[model samples]
Target: MSLSPILDLAGLTLEVNHLARGVRFYSQVLGLELARHDEAAGVAEFVVNPHQTLTLWQPITRQANDERLAPLRPRGASHLHYAWQVEPSDLEPSKGLLDAHGLEWQEINLGTEDRPDWTLYFFDPFGHGLELRGVDRADARQPHFAPTPVQRPPHALPVMGLREVALAFSDYPTMKERLPRAYGFALAKEQEDRDFAQFTLGPHPEPDGNGTPRRWLYAWDPQVGLADMLGGDHALVRFYADVDAVGALVVAAGLPCLRDDHGLAVRDPEGHVFEFIAG
Candidate 1:
């Protein structure tokens, strides 16, 4: 079957408590290249690749004059989850690097379900959950046996291309009802609540050329309770032309901005937390 024209995974923007410290870690350790830094706006971008980007801004200290952070129980993290591609051979070496850095992670074995065999899950210095998976398999019944030679490429954190965002939510059903009402998203697909639910948001036609629009999924996290305290209790996926586009959306929505930590801030519809911003 043809695939739908899914939303391009454009990258994620996060708030940092210390700008210099944050930059130092991601650059020196992860080898990410800085594309831009605007001290005036207190914003910086790490090029993840040609299309993907990671933006970091100063943290919010004073209570927001605009909106408040979503009011939910702390899930003991500030991690924004993202998945990356890896090769079978590189897995061991990559894990070594993670170990050297004292990063903790879990191994998720696919067992020949998808083309990829193993996926390594870990958290960044800032606690963002990241997954790197082998692009190919090594099983006897699978395609290849020999490990492919690979080379490390220069890292770029550009604006991420069309991709999906796994947003954390406190209530799946409430999100299912309130998200569609507050934003312009039509439900595309859903899975049983495994502590979360995935819902499609946005407009991009499917690959069949039948004009079935592309959309994004909102993955709910029941462990997260700060939807109100974080200001954006609910998360929705959509495309923005740039940072300006992000501002425009907030204003247009008529949602009150409870807090602004420069690039990362909280806006409210009572229970939604809009944290990830991209162009």
Candidate 2:
């Protein structure tokens, strides 16, 4: 029997070194509105939209007090790479915003034949890499998935919200079957590469109406991950939807469960760890 999709992507978490510096980069530099911060817990949360949230937690070793936050390990910063969506018209302003702040950014195309999207890449103070994306995909690929409504504060900042999260896996064939079966993430698009294919899940129209839909992408590359340069195949994701059912599915699948402090932390069949937090 196929399991229902448990996570609605309520939020994504990031591990940073310094709390103050990390806050500065995300809040001041990137312009993400500061939603809440618990200094006692050494965590600062940002509002991505009214629904999906982003969090930065300073590992206990990095912050004061030994008993800090749950799922806390001295794992350094998040090497997990992901992209954020911005308005197509705000693309120039986004670039200008980065340039104005003296933050170095690089641009590249992440689109199909007709739809060419220009994405800007930059790193936060904690070395967590991020992208500001905009696209004009005249020929929309795959079935159209409507974006969930998120009444966020405003698009006043270059950083908008999280979408695609790239993780590493060794077996695509096995994962391709088990992932959707376990999580209900549809196989949206598959772009072939030299070694492995880029498989996207739960892809939809850009939340802001541009760029390739948020990539829930996974590629089989064991070489580079989040440990080095924050390019790891691991990610901690939150489930705003069916939390209990998802956790049960992880056990039923016989995949490894690493930690479950604040949520159900489990590895895929390929051994990529993701924290399934219930928001």
Highest lDDT, which number? 2
Q: CA lDDT, every prediction? A: 0.46, 0.56
lDDT of 2 by residue, 5-69 (tens): 44345567777778888787777665666888877777788877665677887766455322322
Off by over 4 Å in 2: 1-7, 62-77, 112-114, 135-156, 170-178, 195-215, 223-230, 256-279
* Candidate 1: tens digits of C-alpha lDDT, residues 1-279: 222222244556555566677787677546667887765445677766554566775544443312334342111124555455444466667776777667776776645454335656766566555665454333322211122222333332111122335666555566666554443334555645454444443342222111112224445554532212111223322233233444545556675543244343334443434543343
Score residue 22 of candidate 1 by CA lDDT.
75
lDDT of candidate 1? 0.46
* Residue 276 shift from truth in candidate 1, angstroms: 11
- What lDDT score goes with residue 217 in model 2? 48
Query: Lowest summed lDDT over 10 consecutive residues: which window, candidate 1?
Result: 206-215
